[model samples]
Target chain A: MALSPDDVARLARLARIDLSQAELEHLAPQLDVILESVAEVSKVAADDVKPTSHAIEIANVFREDEVRPSFTAQQALSGAPVKESGRFRVPQILQEDE
Target chain B: MSGLVLQTAADLAGLIAAGEVSAHEVVAAHFERIAQVEPQVQAFLALDEERALAAADRVDAKLAAGEKLGPLAGVPLGLKDIFTYQGLPCTVGSRILEGWHPPYDATVVKRLLDADLIIVGKVNMDEFAMGSSTESSAYKVTHNPWNLDYIPGGSSGGSAAALAAFEVALSVGTDTGGSIRQPAAVNSLVGVKPTYGSNSRFGVVAMASSLDVPGPFGRTVLDAALLHEAISGYDPMDSTSLNLPIPPVAQAARSGEIKGYRIGVVKELGGEGYAPGVLQRFNESLALLESAGAEIAEISCPHFTYALGAYYLIMPSEVSSNLARFDAMRYGIRVGDDGKRSAEEVMNLTRGAGFGAEVKRRVIIGTYALSAGYYDAYYGSALKVRTLIQQDFDAAFAKVDVLVSPTSPTTAWKIGERLDDPLAMYKADLCTIPANLAGICAASIPVGLSSENGLPVGFQIMAPAMADDRLYRVGAALERGVADAFGGPVLNQLIGSPAWDALSAQAVAARFPNIILGLAENLS
Candidate 1:
């Protein structure tokens, strides 16, 4: 199915990426081509076939619950683009009056 | 000690062990080579000369104290930018993580260090490992050492180019789709994608969590096997890592015998759309194997045709989910973060500014595929198709001990040839994706030069999961047989080529003048 520009915009929002109008227009047709090409999967995949999430077979893996040396707060926050008081600082989440 | 950069990893290890050369000398030789050729090849994104020399010094000190060094001691390596090395940038070839230095090392990085391999630098890749060529990298474009005008297939292009240029004997690369294998194929190097879960992914930046696997590259089969042995095995840090003992691949590579082995040629991989020169080399390798007493059979994997289509759907779906962690609040570059703006706005602005066109395209496609109405039609069906592809492998392996195919459909194209067409780029991985979907081991070894372009073509050898040794044995045998036919290793043809020397002296800006300047301006 051909994706409309509105559909592309909705996807960009869902993905939390802000796409310019030109980007949405450019990507819509490419996404449509990719989507149509990949639609071939529907032709051969049988109903009984089990979908594979992880290619390898491993069950819930457990490690010892013993405490070990972990990254210090400073090290953990080193790469943060915005940090304050040993925490990741972000733009305000809630509005002033809300 | 002269020409030390040209030695194989195994040979260098032997030299280091026997006290013929110090690890420091080996590391210095590689750094010299890098300084010479890196300008032309554009293989490295970042180089920590002090850190690499310090690491090499430690190895020399250990040897002086009479302590036995690791198996691959003194071999210089190029670490792909995706794998984190503490205090070094882990950009994963995207502007989103441009100067983000990780606090910890990737499991593979630590393992390679413990084995005493001096890491020369972090190499370039396609942005977030998204594209077939390194053209999508937000940084410099990596040129194929053989010819500057053509690409070194990616997203492991830098790693492959490093080996081809003799800048490093070994390098680490991740194969989410054909990243490792395809680059190695075009560059005339050896690349391995171990069975899924065989290598830990603790700190390698995830492109597709289910498909991302860190592997090794070398100019020779045994060299790749040695590096593979150093980096692979189960890691508790990675939940999906297999807990079984790593296969004895180094020994198998040394043995180089595949006598009486059953080799199956996949009917789907190499007929239509395959370049003539690629097919010729592939058939010659098959004939060589048959003459060596191996049984060759034509096997049909009908579902293989759909593997590429399935991969595009599933890989992007996982890419979208995996890449969501790069919000503006933490890590790397943030944009439009005025105090008055909301966190959501800042995130959207940062993502919009940071991610490249290819990355944005995949993310949108993935979001649409996983959206409410399209999940079953796209992502769900892709998963089912993965099962069908795996089943095809199971049926094929039941008849043959291993499978063989062309690593890629053709030789490397000119740098800008496929930039406008994403679908054409995706088709480059068609021959290599089925093995990833099946969770098996596959390696690409240089077959011969393409008669058409005089560029290298790789012959892929695949073995069942946990049967990785079989791939090495067959690959080594083919390498030995083909080396004898060609007078020496296939890469030997590239050693003194005037084209390589001329390309090495030319600046990358000269090749893509306007585009690179535009990228530089954007980054600034």
Candidate 2:
């Protein structure tokens, strides 16, 4: 239940947020208390009870696949911080992860 | 004209429908009231005056043409910032989404438009609906109209405050964990969180998906119910929306009677930890319900004690997954791009820079909860707890028709009182969280005023899932009983008054040496 500083750091990395040392220090105890409090749920709830993700019982309700018109390439690129030859430019990855 | 601002949506609609008042006049009056009180309350993020008037004119044009308008025609309402409207910027109250306007209208918004309601504006909220108080709104803090120094409750605080300030007759708000009810409790408005799938969530900015419910806040229970009737139904767009008949909420509210009703007050709520004034009001309200031919008893849901813990875990887990979509590329608000870096790296940088502190905190917690080694320990276990809580409600509902409790553990606290401590803020929803966890419909109605600080107090009426009509029926009867017993609703009396007179007097004495008299207007 106790979250160590390393645990906090790992969580930050997983969440992709950069945290300052002071923030990490502050968050460690806060998260510890929160986790400790929530730990009680495990005590009351049994292993046999099925976990619920949605409050209501529902299943897939997908829309029919169809071609939909999109904004102009210029309009799409208008808000991008940077653009290149009508495409979005970004940092290189895997040298080509996608 | 002044009383028109205080009229319920039902009354306003009747007047508008009967040709006694033009829709345009009603809209204009509300616009005037907004101009008067909006400066003090900070309820709205966006108000399209021209659009509202044009819509009102159209409603009038229909009436003039002898066409039957809808029940809510010309009734001005506020939309929480989360619901996406075609041209309106849906910021979700975060700087990261400064001017992001979706190309589509949320299903609920479309439904409301079909219902002939005029949207006066978008209300402010806690950024991404993360915070318990509206202070987390990127725009500004929404002040409680009763006491400007106090919080109006959040993340639907702006909608509640708008209702409290008489700016809007009814407003739509999304409740994840008591967001709608808590704010309603603080501002003494009628707010209901329906069974999770009662309303469509297509355009709502995701908070904790499972718990997020779009509901109505109004000055009267009937108004709230009427609004609910307007918006509830199956939506094919949202897979989670229940394929069920929309209950007749408006009819239930009209015929709301508590004779022979079995109402059980939760043993966990209204205990030692509650402020004395809040407990007193709750007790008095319970007594009123009992006197009104209702049978009241104490019911214990042992597993209910762990609801907050389970909620925190479950909410963050979902939020972590839900917010992951805001990676700057697919939608609005992108941050830095080192240009040479990959799309994933740019997304990371954008989210890192765009999100506020509390949002980042939740995302981190959510990520931790859903992480590899911890998933079973946190999210899975928390979900198990949620199931147990649902069973608890199931068992309790078998013994009684519905549950009753103080809507919140405490009345509205001062703005800065619990902001420094997020846990303390989370604890404020203790009394209201059980219903959300159980996925039942819950309503909060003004019971009385907390004499300690003279702020509004609220009582919660909860019903089993899909029994949303019962919540309004019981709530309306309880509201009438409490108001009758108290001579008037507490919120009507507290508007524009200092919530904590002693605190105000002390500050005035310290700051103004010569001032010995209490100045209500000057205090705010």
Please give the distance, in angstroms, between residue B409's alpha carbon in candidate 1 and its true position after superposition.
0.2
Instruction: List each candidate's DockQ score.
Output: 0.86, 0.55
State the DockQ, from 0 to 1, for candidate 2.
0.55
Model 2, A1-98: lDDT tens per residue? 58877888888777776567787787888888777778777675576889877666667677879987767787666545446788875556566454
Superposition error at B168 for model 1 (Å) = 0.7
Report the lDDT tens digits of candidate 2 across residue range B291-401.
Answer: 878899999988778888888888988888888877666456665554566666667666766777778778888888888877887888888888888888998999899
Residue pairs of candidate 1 with colliding backbone atoms: none
The C-alpha local distance difference test score for the whole of candidate 2 amounts to 0.81
Fraction of true interface contacts that also occur in model 2: 0.59
Lowest summed lDDT across 10 adjacent residues in model 1 chain B is found at: B511-520
Per-residue lDDT tens digits of candidate 1, residues B279-315? 9999999998888889999999999999999999899
> Residue A2 lDDT in model 2?
80
